[model samples]
Target: KVMGILPFSAPSCGLITKTDAERLCNALVYGGAYPPRCKKEMNGGSLELQFTDRSFKVYHECFGKCKGLFVPELYTSPNAACIQCMDCRLMYPTHKFVVHGHKAQENRTCHWGFDSANWRAYILLGQDYTEKEEKARLELFLDEIKEKFD
Candidate 1:
């Protein structure tokens, strides 16, 4: 099942551009970067998501204060004071979607986008699958997304 859906977008002047989106998708699918690593850091109790070119450092304190997954770039602006965080719910195995065989729950919107200056790709999280199975699933998903742009 899909634990999370991370949509990578390219926004220019606060608007998402198709060209940028396609470019981002291409670089992500073809780029020789290592697979994303999501794990807790040993030194700090923070969660780090090492994606293609950038890393998302989510501090432990932010987890409780900020709702959902916090991507600083997506929220904070140079002049903005309040950090707009995504709203997410803590789901268990007994959740409605999980119990009904749904891959992901509906109405859960969590996406990360960037301006033209920076390109980023977020990892898709899955649950209840073996490592091999999860890897195959991710590969298949990427192949399908690449096909859309091609």
Candidate 2:
């Protein structure tokens, strides 16, 4: 599952342009001089975004009844790849799709886009750390191994 779904303000309806995709990616990834890897794919009526490091596959509604609606209120099913988000449940009372990864000792890592209104980041022993933690750890690790370029 991808992070939180941000509402598209433009009148193009639910359609996302290339520029919008890039901007959103940078905002989510947060790189000072270099941004993370993001690939936008137009799959039928949905816009799919794949982020490299985060291992997220985000799907957005580009057409149909959910047009102009980001996230589009999910419905629960018995699918193996679905897990309801605790943070998003207060705002959206529905189950969300989830994907599991083999890395990190085969833990169930979930992604959530951080919206100021839905900012509830938590870190469990088996769960992914909050963005703040990730950023801090990343900076420390990078500093240890980074090459000085003059």
Candidate 3:
């Protein structure tokens, strides 16, 4: 897989562009830097014979030019007297959760981005997972991303 996220510095953040976040996500969820997936079948059947549940697990392999810095919002409210930044997108507060994969322990999840307008991202958080599982699931997701994005 070729490296796709051309690294460049972000003037304001004094780091790299935020697109790197998506790129790392894309790679971890896809195969190559472009998120390519190679599907394998375990179901016992052939195309000429029949087709059953196509359901399967997903993975997002790791592949990126470099590690992307996380832009965790800080220092201000997204919905202040003069709303600005992404946190102000959704005025209503909500709680979105992250979930684990086929194997996950109950009551295990991470929460972030509170009191911000980007609550949709928080509210839309799907599923739950452990730190180790998140890494594994992320690789699987990257594979899926490759299938769609590539």
Candidate 4:
């Protein structure tokens, strides 16, 4: 099932471009970052979203929707490989996660962009601030996966 959707996982589909993924990642991060100042009349929780023309529609809209929008409950992707975030699931109880591998595990290693030290940064997110959000809010609920190593 994952192979059907994940671009990096699938060989046949090359529709996922580097820039497109980056844009999508940025949109999602921004949507998650800035919640509208409005609030639920009863609960006072923010119910907001900023949609784009290229957004996937349903899932994207709901990302900024109120808490009770869904009935059966839906689960989002854990390691948004395109954006490189890992632990944002700690925000809400209903938001679930898919654990890939332990940080110290040698098997789950990656080489991010090469840096100036001339040493390969073989760690999670390839040393490109994988888990850290370049735009996502750090002081909010998405703190667990904010640091380079947590």
Candidate 5:
């Protein structure tokens, strides 16, 4: 039998149709990055998929490089506010999340601008919603953020 291994980064392979890719992306993102929890059929795969928790590195806005500084190595606190670059700890308040394919600017400046095109649709877990519902969800998220830090 012909078999191949896929990387965790590219969960949606070129061989997958758009619809199927959407389904897969939804499962990967909303299921807390676990595919098996979202889809039962995925459990039958011989391939072993392992992933780290939400931890990710930060490419310092100051230096602009990876520099082998991983998030897990830098911070002891659970809050993102506590996470900092290894070299410039407690210096820069805002740092890019340093994840591939997504640019999440960690801003504390209170500017509420969001690029609609940049929305990570895969994180929605295949839920179909109207524009009104989408707006409500966005507002709810914003409200929660305000409540958390206010």
Candidate 6:
């Protein structure tokens, strides 16, 4: 059963660039300078997620690239460079989440994102479980989440 649907967006406009997405994916798949760290915990470990604040880096980069661009109209038209920068910051994973108390207390990385073509968000689980097991685990986790919110 679907518990609830909550809408969320990135906190800032310049944070989701392709370069940062590549960097984050590399950090997750391989190893990088900034690795994943637990950003928040909720409901006594029922849910926890890894989030790194790269806002400073994103702001610096965006400003550096867009500072000098000329805007034809103030307020009415935005600078082209600024628009491009914002466009580059689209459709990246906001964070990585883990749902605890699953049988062996396994640590799983779930990637959540929206597919515009399908008009739905999907949770792609890690490869540790088979397809059937993945579905069961996800349902169990969703139930736990629903219980907490309800």
lDDT of each: 0.27, 0.25, 0.25, 0.25, 0.29, 0.24
User: Taking the tens digit of each residue's C-alpha lDDT, what string does model 6 give over 58-147?
Assistant: 111110121111111211211111111122221122111111011221112223342212211222222344579655765564344224
lDDT of 5 by residue, 50-147 (tens): 22353233232211222212233223332333223333222111222221122222222221332222222211211233478755764464344324
Tens digits of per-residue lDDT for model 1 on 19-127? 3343334334422211124233335543333222211212111101222222223222322211111222211111111111122322223223422222112222233
What digit string (tens of lDDT, one per residue) describes model 4 on residues 61-121?
A: 1112221111111123332221212222112212211112112222122224322122111
**Of models 2 and 6, which has the larger TM-score?**
6
Candidate 4 residue 29 C-alpha distance from true site, Å: 3.5
The ten-residue window of minimal lDDT in model 2 covers 61-70
The TM-scores, one per candidate, come to 0.19, 0.16, 0.18, 0.17, 0.20, 0.18
> For residues 1-150, could you state the per-residue lDDT of candidate 3 as single tens digits?
134333333233445433344333433542211101212342442111111232112111112111111111210233211111121111111111111112222111212222222323222212233478765765464344324312
Per-prediction CA RMSD (Å): 19.0, 18.0, 20.2, 16.2, 17.4, 21.2
Q: How well does model 5 score by local distance difference test? A: 0.29
lDDT of 4 at 96: 15
Which residue window of length 10 is worst by lDDT in model 4?
Answer: 54-63
For candidate 2, write residues 1-150 as lDDT tens digits. Answer: 133223434444566544344334533542211111312332453322212242211222111101111121121222112112222211121111111111122112123352311211211112233588765664453333222120
Give the C-alpha lDDT of model 6. 0.24
Off by over 4 Å in 5: 1-42, 46-98, 102-130, 145-150
Model 1 vs. true fold: TM = 0.19
> Clash pairs of candidate 4?
112-126
- Comparing 1 and 6 on lDDT, the stronger one: 1
Q: Lowest summed-lDDT stretch of 10 residues in model 1? A: 90-99
Candidate 5, run of 10 with poorest lDDT: 117-126
